[model samples]
Target: MIRPMRLVSIEQILQARKLLEGVTRKTPMEHASDLRSLHGGPVYLKCENLQRTGSFKIRGAYTRIHGLSEEERARGVVAASAGNHAQGVALASSLLGAKSTVFMPERAPLPKLAATKGYGADVHLHGAVLEETLAEAIAFGERTGAVFIHPFDHEDIIAGQGTVGLEILEQVPDVETILVATGGGGLVGGVAAAVKATRPGVRVVGVQAQDAAAYPASLAAGKPIRLKEMHTMADGIAVGEPGKVSYAHVADLVDEVVTVTEESLSRAVLLCLERRKLVVEPAGAAVVAALMQHPGAFTPPIVAILSGGNVDPLLLLQIIQRGMTDGGRYLKLRLRVPDRPGSLVAVLSRVSSMGVNVIDVEHSRISGALAIGEVDISLALETRGPEHCEEVARALQAAGYTVV
Candidate 1:
């Protein structure tokens, strides 16, 4: 069975603060008045989404890299990550004038790859999945005598990430609860340690994408467990297993861990864009989603960490479209109508009269649940929003043709 989390001492946190001097950014702890009022409590946001490389990964990367001996630094560094961690390590290594190589999965986001390259890392695209890429990085590190910078799973990296917790305590003195997104548990483990050490009563909650939640299962199994397969839009936290060191810390310090659905995560992404005017990746939005899903779980004066913002432009566009659809701004429907010449024109005229802009329309006679004398019409329409969409649907229903 996994032992309870060991409380990190205040001295350890102090040492981490000193070691991280001039390295980590003092990320803002801003009062999210809108979110607070929406939740009927005080809510603060730890804006690590604005941190260097667009995530808190830099804190750990710098701490781990700087802690290396002269010989290790001289030999250079290597790491594997799909997004933020790759950029973090690359930028940290560049700033330290150390040679760096980053192994990324083939499906890694283009923007992350670009950012890693921009930070002067030799970017190597390998493997279809993160596991393959990480395995390749380890092999490369072993063969070349270069240091393998793990994304998490190390004491130094965990301690480094703990700095965020340190900043939160200083910035939000009354913070009763802290919410963070989790993957391999590094950030949550580190943050929990720091927070619990500083304020013994403060609750540190971890969130995970529902599909990739290894922590919950690990906690049940009493050890870090691996999943046979996992899938989630929050790919940043799509780790199959919890990190050993991170699990140890979380088991003791974190108050609890929760899982969020993909739908809620999508909405949270929209929430950040619409209300907070922030661009957040899916994994980063999970914490916000968790708070919204379990409203009464946290009391007032809570802090939610916005972890990263390194999303691909194309993926961002798709997410925006998905959000719009989810919000009822876009609608797709299939209908059956008489297979006659004026039938298509009649449908268009009816839809246009309702001010619904037709985005696309398809007519098919061979493939749908249409009678011998009828045709199937599929349409994609743009409406003002959900209300307008419902209005359009009502208008269509009122027409003589049966609406499906």
Candidate 2:
């Protein structure tokens, strides 16, 4: 019987830190000033988004590939990922002077696919989800004599990811809590073991997108459990089933696992973009999302990991609009007004007077909700926020226009 690699040792994690000293970046842990004042305590952000391959995945990927035997390396390696791991393995293989092949889902972001190929790896777009992609990758590895590199689950991978925990301890010795984005549980489980083994007093938390979370259920069941359906904006962490090996460590070492809503994830990403000037992907911002949803839930001297910045540009545009809508900074109003040209001008005048920017305006003369001579007018406006949106709504109402 084949055994799964479990319980990554702190010593292994420490060794990984040494191996990764020059291979992977020692990502900086900086203070979060805005979150600090709100929480009345120190809050730091571990900017792993700035790491090579745009994520912490490279740490493990490099470690795993580096540990392969000379003969094994000669046969090359195959791996699968939604995006982050694909790039990680590709880069790792290239760095180690080994051939690499990466399998990614068809729906994977274009930037990731391009980056994987750019790193000198043969890229194959297959399957619709990670599970299917992973299956194809494993099959190809078997047929081609290439070793299949698991994205997470191996002891080497965990040890490599645990280097982040080591860095946290070294960078912020007084840190009381650490929040990490959870996907396959590689980063979380590995980091948890490293931190708990060294700083027993420090709390390590895992944040997952609620829609696609499997950790909570898996933890409850005392084993890895698969979700029937999973969907979330944080595609980086959207694993239907938690890694068995990673789950073992997580169940034993991780302090708590929390879930963040899609809306919170959107707002967190926007906050990082607007306030911190960081373009954090949804999965990377899951820690921020949790903190936003539950203020004061964690102790001070907290550090949240910004896991990756690999979001598709097209998706980022939609996320920004969703964030604005959720924050009440974007408003859409339907009104029944006279079809006269001056009536449309009057509405625009009121909006301009209120200091609200008009994004779009459309006049519908034949709407079912409108009577004869009454046109259904739709206006999309940008406001300061919820308060401004409310103020503008009242002003429009006061102007004798029926708003629906």
Candidate 3:
């Protein structure tokens, strides 16, 4: 339960903005040409992915560390994170001339782990998941007399994140709606407070991965509730529970919260790469996912916050591969053909005739599904898109080849 206290005020946010003037970059708000006419209004993207440490995490991390009393600062700091916050706290503590330790899950991506260590944190790989890692970090903090930098639950963190909201208002003075990617709600809550305080007429919508959403339930219950399960490709925003401090702000100020599927996240990431030439992580692309899945719901003059860009390279490759499949450019099909020698050649010829590139082909006659005189061929092909996939499918079927 959140303790009753005065909420973070505009004065505090403004003060944070002033403090961060030189510490953080005022990230760009680029107009999204592809979405300009959405709802007959212009759309823009708040590109926080390009921020320091490849995420908005640094803003809060820096603020929280900087706010520590001089005596407290002498004791150092400790934090736990899946990736982005680890890097943020590590980098921020380094910048402040403070000793820092970060606990990360054993399964945390290599690039993030390397980057966090690179930023001067004494990194520990301690647990199988973030929650377990977090517990260890807190224990370490208590053991060593170090300050625990709560990732998204502290007032200072919220205040620092609110600076992004201020930047958005200034960058797009006439913006009508702001769509933010939410995890523990730090970024969105801070943004909502700043945006709604100054411009209550503007809509602030929060988007979360459907597989790990907690905000909707928390809001409905009027308190933070821990989810029983959490899973998603967007690991950055996959918090299973909403933060008490941030949740209060989000529940009161955010206009609505929505969720998007894993497929939408991949498509959104692909769209960002293909159209905007920006490399956004799945969590950062949650705003785009919501827009793609629910374009009609938003009024234009909008800005979608691309919250981070710390995606692991392997995950990115997988998302791209999956995105291609989802977009109908890649296909996998299994079919039974006569066991005769010419059968494989015939299928390859038909596929080639339609200008489809065969990525791989496998045939087996020993499968349970195959008849005595027939072999099953599984083909992975690359086509132009949905229309071309259909054309290829029709051509193969027309050639008396059964596509299963």
Q: What would the C-alpha RMSD of candidate 3 be, to one decimal place?
A: 2.0
* Model 2 C-alpha lDDT versus the unseen true structure: 0.91
Can you give the lDDT of residue 397 in candidate 1? Answer: 78
Which tens-of-lDDT digit does each residue in 1-404 have in candidate 3? 45655678888899888888777899998888887654577889999999999999999999899999988889999999999999999999998999999999999999999999999999999988788999999999899999999999999999999999999999999999899999999999899889888899999999999999999988888889999999899999999898778888888889999999998999899989989999999999999989888877898789999999998999999999888888888988888888997999989988898889999999888887777999999999999899998888787788788888
Residue range with the least summed lDDT across 10 consecutive positions in model 3? 1-10
The global C-alpha lDDT for each of the candidates, from Candidate 1 onward, is 0.87, 0.91, 0.91
- Residue-level lDDT of model 1, residues 288-394, one tens digit each, is 88877787788778999999988888888888788778768898887788998999999999999888999999988997466789998888999979899888878
State in Å the error of residue 251, model 2. 0.3
Q: What local lDDT score does residue 387 receive in model 2, on the 0 to 100 scale?
A: 96
What global local distance difference test value does model 3 have?
0.91
Candidate 2 TM-score, C-alpha based: 0.96
Clashing pairs in 2: none
Give TM per candidate. 0.90, 0.96, 0.94
- Predicted model with the maximum TM-score: 2
Query: What shift in Å separates residue 192 of candidate 1 from its native position after superposition?
Result: 1.0
